[model samples]
Target chain A: MAVPSFLARERIVAKPGFNRWLIPPAALAVHLSIGQAYATSVYKVALVEHFNASLTEIGIIFSLAIVMLGVSAALFGTWVDKNGPRAAMATAAVFWSAGFIVGSLGIFTNQLWLVYLGYGVLGGIGLGIGYISPVSTLIKWFPDRPGLATGMAIMGFGGGAMVASPLSRQLMNWYDDDYTGAAGEVASGNSVGFLFLTLGLVYLVFMLFGAFIVRVPAADWRPHGFDPATVKQKSLVTTENVSANNAIKTPQFWLLWTVLFCNVTAGIGILEQAAPMIQDFFREGGTSAVAAAAAAGFVGLLSLFNMAGRFVWSSTSDYIGRKPIYMVYLGVGIVLYIGLATIGSSAVWLFVALAAVIISFYGGGFATVPAYLRDLFGTYQVGAIHGRLLTAWAAAGIAGPLIINGILDMQGEPGNLVASDYRPALFIMVGILAVGFVANLLIKPVAEKYFEPKPTDVPEAASTTGDRSLTR
Target chain B: MSTARTDDRGPQEGSKGLVAFAWTLVGIPLVYGLYNTVKAASALFTG
Candidate 1:
């Protein structure tokens, strides 16, 4: 198969005095767009009614996309490393947008399979590729502040849903103004199909900009005055590089994976049931429940903390060290989960504040892991390493929801439930956080044997500025 | 005394303005999202 010229890997001709800071926005462009996947719930009901399918059947689209995200990231991590961000990002741009386009066709035809193949399979692969493409590049550009750099890019993924949700809702309203019924319960396949077309094209443009605008740091790049030796002063942070395939062989990899899995599973315990949990906690035996919209607002509030934590907690890790940050996430996470279980209904403020912070740690866990990987493995294939670790996320997604929802199911229905109903799930989350805490405690430096041999050193600024010529 | 090729060395000067621009990519949408979400929350909860 002949690879299109656009998809072909071409060396980025680095120019002296060209800004290294430009890279994060390029990352944000793709991340923010892929973040739309989080907002698919906005259209979930419409699709169900339109396709005349069960909720479980429609839910498979998001499930399959997330499953593919883990699979494709693991499968394509090395490809991303070899082809560079440009090629990987371009491929993601094509797949993500095409997924939506194909999904639109499915909606038009009312063929559920096309929607599955388009949004689920193709879009999921895009999510996987797009997710990791910029990680190593950001780490390379901001060698001194890998946590902050990667956090900014990853934070945008959280923010992307924030943008997409309202925008999608408004777009649906605009296109389907003729319909008069309650929100999210009504149907407008045509409006949704058009919305997909709009989203597909818009995402395509944004991702292309990301691919084209992104440039990798040269072989021997570092920020001005950053001493490579300084990182050695910190225990467990290494200057050595490890290939992604080799990284998993070491104990550090699995430890970090456990850390991610536990943190995510605990966070999802709150997230999967955010709205209902709030109502349940405050309901006082279902006498006066927290309104559905307020519950939604609560989810929105958690998302803010989540996004903010990605930037704030990860940036703090730059100063406090990544391990210590994980300690906070795991240790404090246990406390918060316990508090929510114990005194959650005591006061609304306390409940909201505790949940928000827990959610922050959840987002922090995600944004910090890439930097954590870079510290252990070096930037050579940190993106690839991060990709492999994301399987932990996919695993957590299933486990967290199953445990919480399964427990909830053991109780009666959602609206009628009280705080006591969710108490078991909350206490169980404490155990889950405790496991992550142990994993964080267990994480130490990678064994030296797993590291790749060092490449020959190159002096910074040996290269000239304004060199635009491509070499493959 | 460097034998490493010129092309291998990365950019020398950092651009602050561009950094500010990059932050805006996150900042603008975040602020807007927060506003919208707050509005939605208030309307949903208040009346």
Candidate 2:
């Protein structure tokens, strides 16, 4: 099959003076579209009723997609780096939109496996590729500040959920003709299918703009004020490149992976159960409970913090250095979890503020890790490395929910459980945060032994059609 | 493998006109997204 003309690697190479700032939005376009995966819960009840399936059954779709996200990203990281983002983004767009379209068909036919095959398997491949598509390009373009560039794109992924949750609700409402129906009545399959169709097309259009607009930096390109010599001032921030395979062999890579895994696990605990956790925490004298609406508001606020932290803290890493930035995420994160476990529920305002900060660290951890990789590993295949690192996210997503839910489930139902009921879980999170802090401290400069010796000649494979690499 | 390629965007890399067009084109969706979120978050208070 022929690649689309617009997505041709040679054609999309950035010309001299090409504005690199345009690259972030291109990244955002793809991230935002794929990030819609987070908003799948917006249709949860609707699907459960339509398919007449158990909640757990519907949840398998999400689980499969997430598992596939990690597997595919790790498997395809090298391919994406070799092919360049234009091909990756374009391929991701096709798979993502097609997933929705095919999932729409599954809904129409009332076949659950089709939904799994469509949205779970196919859409997940898109998610994996789309997630890492922009990192290399952005890092290459903004050599002076890899963190800031990646932060912008990663932040957009969180914001995509904010946008999609509301947008999806409205679309579902528009499609549902019988809004005021009987309790047992299921939605017409056509209504749900239509929503999927609309979403698929809309996302495809946005992603196409991203694919067409994205461009590769010229091999010799550098920003006006940038100097290669000055950047070497940070001893740990290497100019040396490491291929993704060699990167896995380094102790630094595993340490960073542990740091990301622990940080994400701690954050996800608060995030996964934000609404229920709040209600449980703020139960007043067994008669008054935090309003469900207000608890949801707290969730929305945390989403804002999550989105803001990505841009704010990650960009800050450029000035403070990546290691120091992680110190804040892991160290401060421990303190906040401890406070939350001990007495966060005593005051509503305190609870909100603490959760907001914790969530920001969560988003910060994600945004900063890619830049962190660039610091330790260099920009040669940073995107592939970042892709490999995202497996940590898939791991944390499960671990976080299990730790929180398991503990809470042991203490009876959420609303009846007092603040003390959550103390054990929150304290566990503190220990998790502590482990991450030490991992961050252990992250010294990657050993020189693992570094692939720089070669002057182009390798046989790299010299082929897709010759758009940093070494050029 | 050579930096001998002649593909540069020239001095006016992101010309004002192109910049404006690109920014505005993407800005619409983003701004709408922000607006939509504020509305939803407001529900927790107003409710």
**Winning candidate number (TM-score):** 2
DockQ comparisons of all candidates to the true complex? 0.33, 0.40
Docking verdict class for candidate 2 = acceptable
iRMSD (1 decimal) for each model: 5.3, 4.0
lDDT of each: 0.84, 0.83
Best by DockQ: 2
* Structural similarity to truth (TM-score) of each candidate: 0.92, 0.93
Rate residue A283 of model 1 by lDDT.
Answer: 81
lDDT (Cα, tens digit) per residue for candidate 1, span A1-472: 2245555444563455567778888899999999998889888889988999999999999999999999999988988876678888999999999999999999999999999999999999999999998998789778889899999999989989999988887788788986443454564988899899999998999889788778876554456667779977887888877889899999899999999999999998889899888888888745645777778778888888888999999999999999999999999999888899899789878888899999999999999999999888887778888999999999999999999999999998867888888999989989988988998898888888887764333233222111122222
Q: Per-residue lDDT for A351-419 in model 2, tens only?
A: 888999999999999999998999899887888888898899999999999998999899887568878
Q: How many backbone clashes does candidate 2 have?
A: 4
Best by lDDT: 1
Global lDDT for candidate 1?
A: 0.84
